[model samples]
Each structure stands twice: as C-alpha cells, then as structure tokens.
Target: MKIFIAGAGAMGSRFGFMLHQAGNEVSLIDGWQDHINAIIENGLEVNYNGQEFNIQIPIYNQKDLDINSKAELIIVFTKAMQLDEMMKDLQPIISKETKILCLLNGLGHEDVIDKYLPAENIYLGNTVWTAGMTGPGKVKLFGTGALELQNIVPGFEKEANEIAEALSSAGLNAKYSDDIKFSVYQKACVNGTMNGLCTLLDGNMNEVGATSTSKTMIWKIMEEFRAVADFENINLDLDYIYDKILEFNDINKLGNHYPSMYQDLIINHRKTEIDYINGAISRKGTKYGIPTPYCDFLTDLIHAKEDLLDAK
Candidate 1:
C-alpha cells in the first residue's frame, strides 16, 4: 500500500517506520520544521523493541508536499485541535479512492473529518501502542499494542477488513471492530482520566497513581464519563475501565511515562486536546441534561493551565 502519515509525531513516526519496514511505500507529512529537517538530514532515528535502526523514509513539511502526490491510505495522527487544518492542507492528495484512518485520542473527530471526506472514506480506531520522542526526528517505541477500527459507512466491511489486513501485515495487530464508537469511548475514558490528571498534577503515571487520593479522584472522573456515555446509549463498564486505569499505577508497565498530553502541555508548551477529551464530555453532558462536574472542572483547570503557561 502506498501510505501517507499526517502529523508524524511520536505515534505517527512509529507507524510510518513500521509500515515502511514492511515494504510499503510510506511518506510522512508534519508541520514541525525541526522534525522535518532532522529526518531529511539523517533519516528517522527509531528505537523499536530494544533494537535501533535508521531507516530513510521520504518526508515532507505539510506545505512542501507536492500537491500532485497521492496515497492509498492516509493515517491521521494529528492532534484533535489541528485536524481541520491538516485536512485542509492535505486536500490535494485526498481522492474518492483514498481511505483515511484516524487514530487520534478523543471524541467527535469523525465530525471534523466528515467535512472533507465522505463517510465511506473515513475509518475510526484506537491503539494501545505507545511511542515517544527523545528529540526531533528521534522516537522511542516500546511494547506491543493492538488496533481496532471500523469504517463509518455500512456495507464497507470488505474494504475495512482489507485495510486491517494491510496494517496487520506491518505487525500492527489490527482488528476489524463491530462497534468502533464503543471502543472510541472506552479509549477516551482512559485518556480523560490519566491525561487530564497527570497534566494538571505535573507527574508521570507512577507519581500520579501513588497519591493517596488517586483512585477515588480517578473514579469520580470516570463516573462522569460513564454517565455521559450511558446517556448516549454507550454503556461503559466502569469496573473494566477502572481496572485499566489502575494498570498504569504499576511502575513496571506504563507508570514511568508521561502521556502525550503531559508532553504537549508541560514539556512542549503546546496547547492540549482537552476540548476533545474531558471538555467534550462536559459539552455532551450539558446537551444530554447530565451533570459532569468532574469533567467540567478538569476541563476548566486544563484550560487555565494552558493560559497561565501561554501555551500555543
């Protein structure tokens, strides 16, 4: 498959490396000039599963990508706030036959994608795979993860399955989902609880989880998410989601790492996707006549932090 990855951050770069190593024609598009320059100068510096390799995959700044270039599959890893801008910039490569898969963290992304592409062309999914950057053009990818995805349009199972197979060929552990919306909400709960709290507290998973009040506080947040999700007819298993949150408390797992939001808001001084995560819950809860005090408060606090830091 001729693939293009939009965003090319930690997750995007990891996916691009894996797909390229699998012999797919992969190209990268990112707005980060330093990252673009670093890769173009020295290839992508990737440390995957304890092995290091320098693989030269074609890369471009969003504005520098040739308008005539086309892709069969375009995996979107752009931040939620930047999705619309990315969709606009990549318009020249989008076509009737192009399939777009969104692996971003949060909710209501499909609505933004819908403006640029038909329902049949949009695919939604989430992953447990993790990646991070040590510096520009350098990424550390560890552990194994699975991907779940479904096409938005009905009667597109065959095409969706084919895309899954292609991803699985690259060792992405892709699975076709019967209820992707449910999966999306499940992932959102995970992000909402961990990312929001960790960023506010300025701690990694272990530090945040070690707090005496962590469980109770996290439970309150998840309860709000569950309430809003249930109102939308998406029943979330609180126990199951809570257990997933607790897993990060173990130092041997993902405890030592800061989530993407922490990296964006604290370390990088960039704006976060709070509006898509907790903020989205707050908005939906308002629409559904449900109270989401925890989410509402967290959303407000994150925004205030952004303002205090003058985050771009």
Candidate 2:
C-alpha cells in the first residue's frame, strides 16, 4: 500500500516505521519543521520495545509535499483540534480511491471528516498503542497494542478487512470491527480518565492509580462519559471498562508512561486535546440534558492548567 501518514508526531512516526519495515511504501506529512528536517537530514530515531534503531523514511512538511503524489491509504494521527486543517492540507493527495483511516483519540471526529470525504471512504477506529517523543524526529514506542476500525458505511466489509490485513501485515494488530463506535467510546474512557487527570495531577498512570481515591475519582468521571454515551445509544460496560482503566496502574503495563496530554501541556507547554476528550463529553451532556459534573470539572481544570502554563 502506498501510504501517507498525516501528522507525523509520536504515534504517526511509529506507524510509519512499522509500515515501512514491512516493505510498504510509506511517507510522512507533519507540520513540525524540526521533525521534518531531522528525518530528511538524518532519519527517524526510534526506540521500539527498548530496541534502538534508525530508519530513513521519506517525510515532509504538509506545505512542501508534492500535490500530485496521490495516496492509496492515508492514516490520520493529527490532534483532535487540528483534524480539519489536516484534511484540508491533504486534500490534493486524497483521490476517490483513497481510504482515510482516522485513529485519533476522542469523539465527534467523523463529523469533521465527513465534510471532506464520502462516508464510505472514512474509517473510524481506536488503539491502545502508546508512544512518546523525546525530541524532533525521535520517538519511543513501548508495550503492545491492537487496532479496531470499521468503515462508517456498511457493505464495505471486504475493503475494510483488506485494510486491516495490510495493517496486521505491518504488525499493527489490526481488526475490522463491526462496532467500532463502541470501541471508540471505550478508548475515549481511557483518554478521558488518564489524560486530563494525569495532566492536572502532574503524574503518570501509576501515580494516579496510587492515589487513595483513584478508582472512585476515575469512576465518577467515567460515569459521566457513560451517560453521554448512553444518550448516543452506545452501550458501555462500566465494570469492564473500569477494570481496564485500573490495569493502567500496574507498573508492568502503561503505568509509568505520561499520556499525550501531559506531554503537550507540561512537557511541551502546548495545548491539549481536553476539548475533545472530557470536554466533548461535557458538551454532549449539555446537548442531551445530562449532568456531567465530573467531566465538566475536569475539562475546566485542564483548561486552567493550560492557561497557567501559557500553553499555546
């Protein structure tokens, strides 16, 4: 598959490396100048599962990319806030046959994507794969993860399965799901709990889990998420989801890792996806007449943190 990964940040770069290693023709498009130049001059420095190596993959800033170069598949990894801008930038490369696989965190992204592409062309999915960036063009990928995605429109199961197979060929552990919406909500629960709370607490998953009332606090927030999901008719197993969130506290899993929001707000001093995660739930709650105090409070707190840090 000729693939172009939009927003080549930590997760994007990891996917680029893995797909390229699998002999698929892969290129990266990112807005970060230093990251683009670093890969073009040297290579993408990667530490995969504690094994360090370098690979020369083609990378470009979105503006510098050749507009005529079409893509068979474009995996979107942009921040939720930047998805529209990314779709606009990649428009020239998106042909009718191009399949867009969006694995971004949070909710309501498909609405944004719908403006640019037909429903059949959009694939919505989520992953538990974790990645971190050390600096421009360098990323650390740890732990194991799986992907669940589905075409928004039905009757494309064969095409969706083919895309899944291609991703699985690259060690992405991909599966074509019939209920990707449910999977997305499930994944959002992880981000909503970990990303906002961890960033506010200034701690990793382990620290949040180690807190005396971690479970109770997390449950409060997730219940809000569930209420919002219920309004949308997305059934979520609170017990199952709660147990999965608790597993993040284990050091052997993703306990030591700081989530993407933490890296954005604290480490890089940039804006976060709080609006898409907890804030999304809060907004939906308002629309559906459901009270989501915990989500609303967390959303406000994360924005306050961003303001305090002067985050852009």
Candidate 3:
C-alpha cells in the first residue's frame, strides 16, 4: 500500500510507523513544524508496550510535500476543527484511485470530507487505539485496541473490507463495519465523557473517575449526548457506554494518559476540538429543541480555558 498519513499527530504517527514497519510505503504530512523537524532529524521514536524503538519514516510539512506524488491510501487524523485546512493541503496527493480512511474523532466529519473528496473514495471509521505524545517526535503507545471501518458510500462493503484487510496486515486490528456511524457515536460518548471532564479536572482518566464529582458530571454529559444522538437516530446504550469509559480509568487503560484536550490547551497552548465534540452536541440539542445545559456549560468552560491559556 502506498500510504500517506495526513495530519500525523499522535495517532497518525502511530499508524504511519506501524504500516511502514509492515512494509508499506508510508509517508507523512503534518502542520506541526516541531514534530515534522524532529522526525526528519531523528526517526519517529515509539515506545510500545514498554519497548522503545525508532523507524526512519519519511515525513514532510505541508509546504514541503511533493504535489505530483500520489497515494493509494490517505488516512486523515486531523483534529475536527482542522479537517478543512488539512484536506485542502492534502488534495494534491489524492488521485481518483485514492481511498481515504478517516479515523478522526467526533460527529459530522464525513460531511466536511465530502466537500473535499469524492464520496466514493471516503471511508468513515473509528478506533479504540490510543496514543500519547511524550515529546516532539516521540509517543507512548500501550494497551490493545481495534479499528472498525465502513465505506461512506453504501454498497461498497467489498472495497471497504479490502482496506480493512490491508490495515489488519499491519496489525491495526481492522474490521469492516456495516454500521460505522453507530460505532462513531459510541466512541464520541467515550470522548465526551472522558476528554472534557479529565481536561477540566487536570487529571488522568483514573484520577478523575475516582472522584464522585466527576462521576456526576459524566452522567449529566452522557444523558445530554444521548438525547442529541437519539435525535440523530443513533441509539447508543447509555449505561454500557458510560461504564465502558469509566472502565479505562478504573484499570488505567491509558496508564495516566491525560486526554488530548488537556495536552492541547494546558501543555501546548493550542485550541481544542471542543466545538466539534461537546459543542457539536449543544448545537444539535438546540436544533432539536432539547436542552443540553451540561454540554453547553462544558463547552463554555473549555473555551474559557482556551482564553486563559492565550492570556497567559
């Protein structure tokens, strides 16, 4: 597979490194200059399951990418808010035969991708795979997770499954899904609960889940997310989803991993994906005439945090 990982952040780095190690010709493009230069100077250093190693993978910034180059598979890993810009930057590498696998978090991303690429070329999916940034070009990856994917255009199951098989060959644990949108909503529930609360509390998933206050917040947020999802005709098992998110905290699934929002606002002082996550729920809640006070407040709170970072 001639693979190009667009956005190449934590999860993108993980996928590109894994696929490249599996003998696929993989290249990467990212907006972060620090990360790009780090990888260019010294291969991406990955610490997986307690073993640390490096793979000399080719990476480039948007300015440096070769426009005439083409890709067989282009996996989008951009933050929800960054998708439009990323897709535009990645356009030159996309050909008619290009299969775009978007494992980005949050709802309503396929619509955005649709604007930039052919609908038939798009693959909508989600993953439980988690990775954390340790430095500019280094990441810590642990635990086991699977990739579940589906073709955005209906009646393309065989084509979607072929991509899954290719990813599975690289140990991505890929599976073709008949209902990936459902999986995506389910995954969003996990993110909405853990990412917001964990970031606000400045704690790891375990640390936050240990608090009664956090549990109460999780319930409120899930209920609001449930109502909004229900309006969209996505039926999520509320109790199962809530408990599943907490299970990561209870057992240290990510092992003291502070959710990405925390790293973005607090550590790097960058903006977050709040507008697409909880903020998206709040917007839909408004459209459906359902009250999502909890989500609304959290969205405001995250924005305030962002403002505070900027002020500092």
Candidate 4:
C-alpha cells in the first residue's frame, strides 16, 4: 500500500517508519524544513526498547509535494489546531478511492475532514502510544500501545480492516472497534486528567501519580469528564475509566513518560488539545445545564497561561 503521512512529527514519523519497515511504500508530508532535510539526507532515527535504529524513507515539505502522487491511504497526525488548514491543503493529493485516517486527539476532527473531503473517504480512530520528536529527523518512542479505529461511514470496513492489518503487521497493535467515538472519548479522558496535571506540576507521570494533590485533581477531572460523557449519551462507566487511569499510573505503563500537553507547554507552543478534552466538558456542561466547575476552571487556567506566554 502507498501510505502518505501528514504532520511527520513524533507519532507521524514513527508510523511512517513502522509502515515503511513492513515493506509498505510510505511518504511523509511535513512543513518542518530541518526534520525533512535531515530525514532526506540521513534517515529517521527511531529509539525504542533501549535500542536505536534508522530507516530511510521519502520525506518532503508541503511545498515540494507532488500534487499528482496517488496514495491508497493518508494518515493525518497533525495537531488538532492544524486540522482544518491541513485538510484544505490536502485537496491536491486526495483521490476518490483514497482513505483518510485521523488519529488525532479530541473531537470534531471528523467534522473538519468532512468539510474538506467526502464523508465516505474518512476513517476515525484513536491511539494510546506515546512518542516525541527529540530533534530533526529523530523521534523517540516513549511507549508502544494499541490503536482503535473504525469506519464512520458505511461500507468502508474492508478498507479499514486492511489498514488495521497493515498496522498490526508493522507491530502497532491496531484493531477495529465498532464503538470508535466512545474509544476516542476514553483516551481523551486520560489525556484531560494527566496532560494538564503534568503541565501544571512540571513532572513526569510517576511524579504526578505519586503526588496526593495530583491524584485528587485527576479524580476531580475524571468526574467532570464523566458528566460530559453522560450528557453526550456515550455509555462509559466512571469506575472503569477511573480504575484504568489509576492502573496506568502504577509505576509501569507511563510512569516516566511526560504527557504530550506538558511537552507542548514546555516548548512554548501556543496550542493544546485541552480545548478538546477539558473544554469539551465545559461546553457540554453548559449545554446540559450541568455544573463542571473543575473543567471550566482548568480550561480557563490553561488559556490564561497560554495568553501570558503569548504576551511575552
């Protein structure tokens, strides 16, 4: 399969390398000049399981893209804020038969893609793996986890299954889920609780988990998320979700890992998916006349920090 990856940052580069190593034709589309040049000149440096390996794959900045290159699949790994513009820019390369898989965090990504592409061409999914870009052409794999995906439109299961099989073959642990939206929300809850807490505390997962204050705040955030999930009619058990997060914090899975949102704040980046996670809670709470003071407060706090950083 010819796979085109947009964003080509940590997760994107990792997926590109994985697919390429599995004997699939993969091309990366990214705007980062240094990253693109480094990968083209050298190769993508992947660090995983205490080992480092390099894989040579085609990398190009958006400006140099071949408008005519046909791809069987296009996996979007861009940050949520970039989704709209990236979808618009992808018009030149997308064909009718091309399947678009979005593994981005937050809700409303499918809406953004549908605005630019046909609904039938889109596939929705979420991932639990964590990765980060250390430097140009270098992506460190913090954790290897599973991906859950499904076709939102009817009659696309065969394509979705094919994509899942290819990812599984690459050792990605990809699976198809009929309840894709709920799965996305499940991961979003984890992100909402952990990501902002890590940012506020300036600590890794283990440190945050070890702190009484952080643990309490995580429970509060989960309560707010649970309310939102209930309002949205998404069937999620609060107990199950809470236990799952606590398990993840238990000195094994993500103990030393820094949440992605925390990394974004540290890098002085202007955007975050908090708007999708906690902000989603606040929005739905308002719509349903439910009190989400915790989410509302955290949303405002992150925005205030973002504003202060921007002012400086």
Task: Provide TM-scores for the models.
Answer: 0.98, 0.98, 0.97, 0.94
lDDT winner between candidates 3 and 4: 3
Q: Backbone clashes per model, in order?
A: 0, 0, 0, 0
Over 204-276, each residue of candidate 2 has an lDDT whose tens digit, in order, gives 9999889998888889988988888988999999899888987877888989999999998899998999899
Quote the lDDT for 189 in model 1: 95
After superposition, candidate 2 runs with Cα above 4 Å error: none
Error of 2 at 239 (Å): 0.8
lDDT of 4 by residue, 1-312 (tens): 899999898889888988888899999988778888999888998887668999888887776666568778999998788888777777777888888999998776898899877898899999987787777898888666899899989888888888899899998899988889999888888888888778777788788888868767877888887777887788777788778777777677778777777767766363677788888788988999989888888888887777766721
Return model 2's CA RMSD, one decimal: 0.9
Q: With candidate 2 superimposed using the best TM-score fit, by how many Å does residue 211's alpha carbon deviate from the native?
A: 0.3
Cα-based lDDT for every prediction: 0.92, 0.91, 0.87, 0.83
Alpha-carbon error at 264 in model 1, in Å? 0.6
Colliding residue pairs in candidate 2: none
* Ranking 1 against 4 by TM-score, winner: 1
- For model 1, the superposed segments whose C-alpha errors exceed 4 Å read none
Evaluated against the true structure, the overall lDDT of model 2 is 0.91
Candidate 3 lDDT score at position 271: 90
Per-residue lDDT over 221-269 for candidate 3, one digit per residue giving the tens place of the 0 to 100 score: 9899889888889898988997787678865466477888887777778
